[model samples]
Target: MRFIKLFCLLISCSFISPQISAQGNKNISATEKKILDQGLVDIQSVNPEILVELKYATPDNFMKKNVYGDLTHAYLQPEIAKRLSKASSLLKKAKPGYKLLVYDAARPNTAQYKLWDALDDLKIPARQKTQYVADPKIGSNHNFGCAIDLTVVDEKGNPLDMGTKYDFFGPLAYPRSEQEMLRQGKLTTKQIANRNILRMAMVHAGFTVNTTEWWHFDGMSKKQARAKYGMIK
Candidate 1:
């Protein structure tokens, strides 16, 4: 009887070990693991109020394919994460029930290559593509975990209309063109106001706005990021 009980316990242990290993591996991708290993903190860990919907983790992005498999959480460098948390707090204070919704953060260089290739396959002109997607060779602030793509969401979790959708590659999405677009009736005043709310919170938290992409913000300049931390491989 004692031998039989021991055998049963061994069998259960063997099954449980593999299950645990598989669950841990499926929780995040290798690229994400590397990002975490490099000391990037998951944004939600710093501020649970900030919502995350990583576009690359789903097919809803401009790529139209899920590039970040099993990697749903948004990560950023420690200081950048703190700034984002501050931005989240600012939004809540300013708008009562609004929240900062993150779309992407701490992208790996490997993912950058995927985006670059996707643009090439789309036959986008070199100059036009660079405006939307950074050349992987040069690296983006995202590669160093200093950039984020985000928007504002109301109390009920609905994202505010920011003129164009996230990742829209056109003049309509350009911050510099917002006034012109509003004057031309392409963007409404309410939409511009919604964008300003998000901009104010982020800027107040010490983030630099990306002029061409309203949803994108950098915690620091590319040169600063490179000097502090090299691109995440």
Candidate 2:
């Protein structure tokens, strides 16, 4: 009888070991889980059709390094996710073949510092770099989970020519300067139209585009977001 009891106990331990191993190896920390559990919602849960690349997760961004590490998902505040979904839906209705392609969302504060440090160009003053990347001290709207850097992609998932590439730090990337860039032969009329399509869809869904960067959009006013949410650590 004792031998049979020992055999049963060994079988139970074998079954439980996998569960313990899985729990111990989970990627999310308690703090990150807490953040997800609260005000933030995974954009994939809200709209899986929305294409998310998360440039910082790969080495493709301006930093030229993977700052986001193993994190592959994009999370935004609940309202932000809804607004992004609405924008994508509008884009789909306007152009059945196109979809919103998110490049970055809900950036962590540490990532901001890494970006800041990467801008080691002595030619560009510290003040100017802050214009492109928010000062870590002030924090960015993305850090508050209220902003997204995105563009429109075609049926083939190729990014539409939005005049300038994502994370291009130049006046040509500015939406407000589109005409100037066009006159300079830097941006073609077709590129401008593509940008307008994205802007119109996002604006119709109540997202405000930043004048400086064509791909950047905010779900809420910066003042309101700053007052309401703490920067993601």
Candidate 3:
């Protein structure tokens, strides 16, 4: 409950972001503007073809201390959206059944999106922060709209547990982590098998999995990853 509240606060403040520091927003290409005119930056409408999986969870361990809240369900910047469409289109082609699960959309409060400070409060070590902290200096890929945090869900809309909850910060959430499941022999092999289904799909879509966060994927396109990444001025 406490985590949820802080998570909400963070999202409410951070979701309406516009590259606070100017950063590289000024360089918006004419083509990018065309995408914006069509409302790529904002949620035009939920894609009916795509399944609606679990939305952002503030109470979740990785984001529990977040004061910036969740932006996955919020409005996106047009410049970023255009690129996302390109990324998503390719992803869908690579993995037909898989869909993008956007967790953090656009941060209205980029300041509150401090992974390091949040981890420190959670008692995570300094060295570990580098591995987890969404660096504000370079900014997160989520900020650029090229990256997304996502997982698979069943036809019933229930999240297929992939070892741990989405955004869970521990080793158990690692893609290749040997850590045991949370419950003592609760979920069966079949459930885990389903979870891996999503992982395999993501890999097929040219995404590189994060060793720590199973829900995370770095989109395969080098062009997208290299360009329009940092949002801070």
Q: Model 2, which residues run further than 4 Å from truth?
A: 1-34
Poorest 10 consecutive residues by lDDT, candidate 3 = 17-26
Top candidate (lDDT):
1
**For candidate 1, what is the lDDT?**
0.89
Of the candidates shown, which would achieve the greatest TM-score relative to the real structure?
A: 1
lDDT by residue for model 3 (1-233), tens: 99999999999877643532222333444433433433435433423344323243254445444344332233344544444445455556655555555555443225325654677778878777767756565565554544556655444555555656665666666656532553446445665675566666656555566777766666534356447443422
How many steric overlaps are in each model, in order?
0, 0, 17
TM-score (C-alpha, index-matched) for candidate 2? 0.85
Model 1 lDDT per residue over 1-233, tens place: 99999999998777753322533434656766777778788888778888999999999988899987767788899999999999998988899999999999988888899999999777889888889999899999999999999999999999999988998978999999999998899999999999999999999999998999999999998999999997898
Give Cα distance to truth, residue 73, candidate 2, Å: 0.6
lDDT of 1 at 175: 97
What is candidate 2's lDDT per residue for 1-233, written digit by digit as tens? 99999999998777753322433434664445545755686787789889889899898988777898756778888888999999999999999989988899988888888887778653567778887988888888998999998999999989998877899988999988999989999999999999999999999999998989999999997689889887788
- In angstroms, give how far residue 124 of model 2 lies from its true place: 2.2
Give model 1 RMSD, 1 decimal.
5.1
Prediction 2 global C-alpha lDDT? 0.84
Candidate lDDT values, in order: 0.89, 0.84, 0.51
> In terms of lDDT, which candidate is stronger, 2 or 3?
2
